[model samples]
Target: MNRRRRQWALKKNLLRAAVLSFAVSCASNAAFADDEHRGRDDDHSGRHPKVEHVLLVSFDGLHEQDVARCIASNACPNIALLAKAGTTYTNAHTPGLSDSFPGLAALVTGGTPKTAGLFYDVSYDRTLYAPSDTSCTGLQGWNVVFDETTGIDAMNGGALTHLDGGGGFNPQAIPHAKIDGVCKPVYPHDYLKTNTVFEVIKQKLPGARTAWADKHAWGYDWLNGPSGRGVDDLMRTEINSTDPATGTDYTDVYSHTEKFDDLHVQAIINQIDGKDSKGDATVGVPTLLGTNFQTLSVAQKAPVAKGGGYLDASFTPGPQVSAAIGYLDTSLGRMVAELKQRGLYRSTAIIVTSKHGQSPADHTKLVKNGDTLSKLLESNNYFDASGNFGQANTKSGSLNDGTGLTGTGFIQTDDVGLVWLRDQKQLAAAVKTLKDNLSCNAPGICADGPGAYILYGAPLRARFGNPAEGRTPDIIVQPNPGVIYTTSTKKDAEHGGNAPDDNHLGLVVFVPGAPGAGERVRDRVETTQVAPTILQMLGLAPKLLKAVVSEGTQPLPGCEERRF
Candidate 1:
């Protein structure tokens, strides 16, 4: 075929696919709306034919390429087994912003950051107040309450209640927010603005049990939202918890974090056995049980001797990386075995994905630079005298004593950087300043700079939402591929960016007795489809989630969209 003809054909095919997808979504939505009006008489929608339980697991920092390579090499046999019995979306992706807060929100809330309102864990909100601001009393807009080094435990609300120390929320532990006109400590679950699939299940299918375990006490809280804890049982074992176990101190979620993840695995097994981890009958067999694994991500960054030493971005799994994959597969294998033993395997739908993929999959591309962005802005007097930026509190003390940024902006630097300018009018000048220093030293700009791709003006608003949207950052700085904004020795890799490895994630859906078992679909999809898919599998309306309707989320293409 001639070049013009081929191009025309491709465009025609693309348009056809888009139209088909849209048609399916509209039809599904209409069917769901009708069912909602008809009440729960036909509760068993039969959309998910054989599926009764849904298991969602995330391997943080897993890339689609890595999954194919690992499974091909037989390093991830359990995952390979799942792929053989399920459909694998080779081109699965996370929504543009790759932060875990927003990434997981897409899966559980069925929306992207635009609808979920979660840019990053430490993003800015224009309408929210700094803790020290007298206008809102003690309410802080930014979610800076996740630091574990600040003498707060990562789980049980930093105390005895599994969320708190038993007395109630620790005033000094959590970020304070004024809810319903009362200023109180902000629990981790309060950060999300949307409803989770768990909440939907609890509301729609009252007797259905749901449980989830995650690296941080608040990791799974992104889904629970403001409904106050949605999961029937939530296990919070801090990945960075130093609380010793098995004669080892938990470092991060990568190195010695397997023990912590194992606890969650055991909990899953117990939950499948129709009980909680403690052998208590508190949480009956959960209809939805899930947890995220971090071992592989850790292995990808560790030194050669420790099991991860990829030569480059080729995604060649080193011993550590390969071992991490094997370990994760084994962990998953255990859960599958338990389900089978209990005769629940055939009735379960398994979803495996990642919150974000690690960047520089080739460790050779890892670059460590100081916070040059902050240094440049601070040196230019862009910050307050104390250089507090807008931070009202740190591990040291509360900045609310009024010593922090009174008129200065805030800077969150990582693989991605968010700059919230206190003076919105200075945005033009700031953008110019950042653009000028994109390479190296330029005039007043310092030396040894990786520069940045500034996201502001029309382009920024076009990609992300409007800056005036409260939580949206005034200026976004996505550093070059190898340039991480911090010099922290803690990790050799980081996510949360537009990098190929950061957004392209592994996705597999396994439903036993389904005709598509062992089939691989090359369709490019997003994790946001996961929530609605799970809801459909559970025989519930996907639009029951507000974000699903608002964002127009669609179920996975191959699934049957039956009307309940």
Candidate 2:
């Protein structure tokens, strides 16, 4: 095996060993559960109270700076209230590759992309075969697989057939994966090889109730992992839904998304009242329930003329940003009000965070270089002739119509780009081309503008994993902060890159009676730590998550003393 491959194999073995050991230890502890206590505080400090439920709220594209800006302006009073009663981590970051799937997975799975195997919502996997050559237009290489769906679902993994399975509008769906040798349809959860906090809770506390509502139904399936279905209550909503009232689709825009998020907020309120949002009382109250808000993300990308904030790092939220933040705070306040009304507020823990933050919040820095990298490689005969001329299966709506690439190997690009060459020998030529054409003198040569960086070799291997691992990209091109690889004039910003704004997120943990209320931790913390910390708060073994076991991921610092 090559050196990189050998290193990966070694790490994989060591990880397995570590996981085995942790599992054994947890099992042993379980045997003595009654003798001591499980998820119960052994500390007599009086400050540590029993934590019954954990409500995790993820705000997509919420930057720490955005929170700071909004809070200073009193736009996000609810979030500020939580921060005042808990520990806020100002230096929190998402695991590298700041996309929604991996970003949230890092929080709920307690592992980086390296351990969780969730690179991005739309990532390349060489080992897996495309459902059919006629579908993605490719057989196995560089296909966009987000849990049985394609990159076409920019909302990322809602059920294909319906919006929240609601009968309001016609269904816009993506093709289900058809792996050559695998019988199962490749749902988004299948792409995630690790266990999530929900799965861990089910295994350790079989009666624990769990629920989640997010952008797309399928993308958040990572909560269930390969178990197919695990969340007791799953509220599937499509942010891309068109208004049945006006027949207008607000797919990526914030104003319309806010309406949809309101549905989730109502669901949370109902869940707190011991009823399902669908009015199913048999479902019972969830011990863990939450949803992500997309309004801020929409505001970040909306044009100023359209009443949106500047999508830059300045953190000066404009009218739209200000309004979005206020709306979100109101939604949060509703949840809090319901919890209090139900008398559950005193026993529940609240966690506010973001799956990923958007980059280039400043509009002036926005650069829309129309897929220059793909054009550069396509001209070099790097892509197959079929499938949108070698671009990702994103633009061509045929992703569900069964007219994708007929072969494998292509370049996938957005705000971030990944290059998967057809042959191993082409690596050198590919690198040379990118390096040589990196000059910003021309419009297309280095599309990254001034300070874009190419990540490969050791740096890529360290943060991700060995490129030979099938899922890891051969080359990763992170364009300048504001450089989006699309020519679409609608979008003002994007995420899924290593830029500071994309990686940094706001994180605050609030346990009603926990000791650290009103405290702040300025230390650098990864989103992965949130999973184990939540597990710890619930009096469950943190090692239940494979990443916690494999990576020695711990709960938030100063959390152990407050855990019950």
Candidate 3:
């Protein structure tokens, strides 16, 4: 009887061991399944399931009307394809000046000039010293010109001639600022007042990478923001530099500009392939990567007689413009194909938009005033005795010349006028002078009925910012829609104005596998919203960006709804 009891006890112990082993095996399998599901559905810590990358492409001069017309005519099949799964914002616009510096800043920083502290590429800063004044003791106000002349070989007088802009910004051309009571050179990255999307992402998502490619190797350094290392990979292909094959500035011809744009296109492809911009190093794919195509912008700026601009007021593209648009469409198609091939199509979000749009789509309305605003101001003794309109002092004497302020102020003009006066007391007199000489025939601004107007005083302060703070323009002149304040004979249209064509942009947010048959959010949106939207898509808080918090910038519509 004792032996039987022992055998029964042994059998019960064996049965308990088997049951325990089965439960342990089942639990292990369940844990593995959970991990697999998490990998697929909770890639970004379960915050967003679809988007792991955001590719932001800026077609420099693309307009909202251009998108509509292209789609209707089937000229932009690739853009149309993206539109099929995207939310097209018809009334999107740049919040401030349409110049490239502020335009790009608005897209990445989520703020206008007021918060970003960037007015133009070549603008005036009252608190900073001139590039020549390394001691920072010569003058408090300097014409901060971060252009081609700021390139690395700028002092050698051959920066623009090289395809790489002499390997980036020249240290000599950078402006000086007084920090900690010491004079310090202010690089492009240090000039901006706000943090960028790249910086925000780096702080929030430690492992994510960011990259960008633009026209100027030097001037575009502002995109790096105050952190100075915001972009992990900033390509150095300069668009304004002379292409060796053509022996002319990239923008001098549309075809040449296309070749220049191809470099950036390839760079984007390399980034997508989990390689560095040069396609050499094996860095993982960046979370945020993009580039700007200058071909369309060059096409729009080309002289109408050379088959550029719209053929009519109905937004019809001329032969050259049409060709440029088609080239951009093809390039975009290549990127889309690359994304799909890598199985990243369902995980990537592409944002297509423009920094600013070319003005006077109506070719007949174009008025090339030929630096009339600056000349008018100069003739009125607004500049020094040497007639220097705060031109940058560079070895090449490229854009502007000598700089010594004995007279009233400096003037920067494109399609509009941005006047910065040394003496604030002359504001009223300057406004009176500008208003007194508004004529199309005279060597001054043209009057296109009620469209032309001047902004200054409290109104200008409200619209832009307080001029007393030094960076804001003392006076702003929004000329007629078709007026371009340039003397260059190469182009019929210009940007950097508040005209409908200049501010109105083509904004499309495309997410693969998104619900709905592509909605059109006609509600007006600003390019500033793009920065916040990018962060939100990454499962990161938009408020991580300082500008978003300060400006109260919201994400683009349909983003929160995951509509596209």
- For each candidate, the alpha-carbon lDDT, in order, equals 0.68, 0.70, 0.80
Quantify how close model 1 is to the true structure by its C-alpha RMSD in Å: 10.0
State how far residue 255 of model 3 sits from its true place (Å).
1.0
Candidate 1 lDDT over 218-304, as tens digits, reads 434555667886787876555554543434345443547677678888988999899985566755788888988878877765654
- Model 3: residues with Cα > 4 Å off, grouped in runs: 1-48, 392-408, 561-564
Q: Is candidate 1 or candidate 3 better by lDDT?
A: 3
Tens-digit lDDT track of model 2 for 257-348: 78878888988988888888666686667878888888888887776667676634477877777788888899998997677666666567
TM-score of 2: 0.83
Q: Candidate 3's error at 294, in angstroms?
A: 0.3
**Who wins the TM-score comparison?**
3
Prediction 1 global C-alpha lDDT: 0.68
Once model 3 is optimally superposed onto the true structure by TM-score, how far is the C-alpha of residue 180 displaced, in angstroms?
2.6
Quote the lDDT for 468 in model 3.
Answer: 87
Q: Which rank order by TM-score, best down to worst?
A: 3, 2, 1
lDDT of 3 by residue, 1-564 (tens): 999999999998887765433100000111122333434322334322357899999999999988999999999988887776567889999986899888999989999888898888888878877666777777577777787766775654444777667876675567778899899989989999999999988878879899999988877888888989899999887777776776777878888888889999999999889999999999999999999999999899888888988988888999888999999999999997777666666578888999999998999988886777777776776655355546543334554322334223567888889999867778889888888888876765774456788889998898678988778999999888898887688789888888888999998787644454367888989999988888877777778888889888988766652311
